[model samples]
Target: MSEVPPRAATAAALLIDALRRAGVRYLFANFGSDHPAIIEALAADRERGLQAPAVVLCPHEYVALSAAHGYAAVTGEPQAVLVHTDVGTANLGGAVHNAARARVPVFVFAGLTPFTLEGELPGGRNTHINHLQDTADQHALVRQYVKWSYDIRTGRNVPQLVGRALQLATSAPAGPVYLTGAREVLAEEVPVPEVAADRWGPVARVPAPEAVVDELIADLQAARAPLVVTSYLGRTQSSVDKLVAVAERLGVPVVEYNAEVLSFPHDHALHLGDDPHPFVAAADVVLALDTDVPWIAASAQPPAGAKVYVVNEDPLQESIPLWYLPADHHVRADSGLVLDQILDRLPAGEDPRAARRAAEAAAAGRRIRAEHERAAAADMAAGRLTPATVARVIAGLVDEETIVLNEAISVAPEVWKHLPRTLPGTLYGNRGTSLGWSGGGALGIKLAAPDSTVVAIVGDGTFYFSVPSATYWIAQRYGLPVLTVVLDNGGWNATKRNLRRQYDGGAADRTDRYWVNLQQSADFPGIAAAAGQARGTTVTRFEDLEDALRAGLDDVAAGVPAVVSVRLDPISHQAEDPV
Candidate 1:
């Protein structure tokens, strides 16, 4: 970019340059026809020594996006997605929702069939392009999930289009953006723009209103005690440093706000995992930061009549949900900027919030201790092996480096405590409520980090959602080994709990009802075998369940895929709720 005159490049190559200039480092995608031009362009870049974002081929559109989601969580930078033109966009939309829910920034590009242009060319190797693929507009498929989307109409428009999308997607409350490349557009000759890095270039304004911040800050200052809850401050390691600085400077107790990845390391003195109800009640002021602020017990909501301040990049637009409840006073601004401003302005002479932070930290320690005690007591008293017992038994068997992917949300406490995640990289779970995702995700994690063991724990309610086909994909594509724990609860345990909580316990008998229960349960182990998992076992008690899991882990360590099904109480599994 040394002020050279414009040079001719294919539209696809120009788009790649724009992305490369935009600081995108990874692209997760599956092969597709309409995208051969882009792939060819990527190939040319490799030939010429223009570095391409490492492309990770995914088996399914969902897996590609999920991997990107995890990558964004790890890197804290925008990750890109390239999919086929028609069916690809349609398949990738669900993955976009996962990114949006996690607030992960993803730039998605889908290739379009250029049938009209093909008609202009002599009979081509890829003939009857219209008959083979779709030329009709497909960007409309994901407009709702993405923040911005448009088809590049001309080759000359590549730089502006890519730059604008990247800038917007990486700004405050980052999420997904969709872009399209017509086959003809990919073929057109255009000059690539001068390379310029754009991330953090535009000032990140708290797009949320300002008055709400003032009101909330005043309310917080007036409170005798306050708690701040968020899933995390930063998505990457660099973000963690800034987050730690803010938390330490403020002397505020930071609670993990319904997070998958550690927002704050669990062992930190001021860090408490989600149980904000008591803390909120005890506090005179409450600050809910980037959190999904809601009680699992829908019956009991966030405490009423407390001085509440809700701050976010986009403050609860129109009574939006943080976790469970709507925000009170909303301030739209960057968390890092706000933390800096508040720290710069506040008193440093005395630590008034120390006692409160200490109290919550103490409570967290007690909660952890109690959970351990409960696990021990259950192990001692369990007559027949159950999910809880099996989990405890397995904990005694696995190594320290083993990684557990938990999809058992209903029995999360069971799985979370079964094998403690004392060290980093020991456990992973979905932050938001997306089931069936873990079945495929665990395989991806294992493949990415193959030196370690990967175990996926999923509830029966979620198992069928991620069919055995997903597992087979893991075996066929990555040759990855994973121990999948199918928690065979009778029904959608979480849904039944909802029904019980609703209608004043009117549907008690629905537990046995056709629609509410797993009356037609599938042969889970058989399904696993069909999906290419050898030595899949169905466990009915702790006698064989833990043993089976240990054997599976060892087999996996020796390069074999395995599955173990454990019977779990659909109701009253671990604790109906963690709180």
Candidate 2:
């Protein structure tokens, strides 16, 4: 047999090289038969010592995408997620919806069923399963959820397609993008394109119009009651700094409602509590900065005469088919850039009423803090293993060097109130309405900040949804040890709360069976232990909580994943219970 000259670079090889060139550091992958070409190309690259994005094998697609989401949230650098055909895409589930809603940039690609059947192509279908896996449109699985979707038709343009896909993925209002290609296309040999790296770069952040900035500042300066609301602006550290500066300069109270990140210091004098209803009702000038839903209209709304301004990268939320937020001004620009513009354009002196407003805000903040502190103390004294109690204990464990992933659902509001995240990047939450994000997100956070202590505060329901075995296995295999503290109330507390909220004396509430309850038979600590080298502990008593948490933290410090499950008091059935 003659030794044939090796064919030119395969599409998969080119794709890997393209990812490296685009500054991708990791490729979270869940493989299948559809990905043989990519698998072989990666192996060949390894043999040749060619530099490419490091591949991290994920047992599930949700974990792969959520890890990518976590990495991007911390580093502001999008990572790649590769999966199998339609089946893998389907398995991605809520992670896809979450990534899109959270505006996290994750490059997700999948292999497709082979186009050829009878050996006409180098990577034709050799198995019977390929026929069953064929889909008319694989991109349809995630098309609506993703920012953009495309299919790579040939190896000749794989690099360009990848470049375009990444450009969109990392651009303003960044979100996940989907790409797919058949096995034969991935295996086809083709020449690399001569393209400049600059061509593939993300679109530069745009500043708000000077006139709009001038008008907004004037409104703040003239208004007696001005309020600033943000959700995820703190995704960037500079944004948080600028927001703080702007709020201080204007003596405007800032409310971080349902915040996905720590937008402003909770201890700041002008920082109001998470509930924006009262503030919204009183705000004469409301600046909704980078927040999607500043105030729920169903619950409360600003005065009809008040000037409401919405500033965001995608102020219009074009992707959302039905979004209606009445705003006097809708400025479509980067929040950080607009904030810089506001800072630069503000008048030299503070307003006459600034001191008065500051005093009022500080008083309001003190009252709110006192209430939270009192609630926590009462829970401690009552020997009730409540969310507030768990949160207070967890708060003691966090520091500037720690990154907390909040996915505790019903318990998250308590976590937010008790855990005062003064630093910008120290705290993060899954804003995508996904149940199983924190485990994978913690892994990604660990990957991004290897020295920082990563902790995931998850609900018991979310723990089951997170594919704990896969996440722990990946953590153990990759040497990424993170502490996971599960706030176990033994059921879907959020679902029960919703049921009660809509129907005060609902049948489910009356029966004390919401149908959202999970089986209490499973031992979470044992599950964690069986998954990997994760040390697991169950804390049923309030006094033992601190020790258990500290032990978990110690395990994490010693380079081992830890799971500390704290069983808490279940949701109250009484109508007087806070919804």
Q: Kindly report which residue stretches of model 2 are placed more than 4 angstroms away from their true locations once superposed.
A: 1-7, 572-579
Q: In order, what is each prediction's RMSD in angstroms?
A: 5.7, 3.7
Each model's total of backbone clashes: 9, 0
Q: How many residue pairs of model 2 clash at the backbone?
A: 0
- For 41-137, candidate 2 gives per-residue lDDT tens digits of 8888777776468999999989989899999999888899999899999999999999999888889989999889999998899999999899888
Q: Against the hidden reference, what TM-scores do the models get?
A: 0.80, 0.96
Window of ten residues with lowest summed lDDT in model 2: 1-10
Q: Clashing residue pairs, candidate 2?
A: none
lDDT of every predicted structure (CA atoms)? 0.65, 0.87
Index of the highest-TM-score prediction: 2
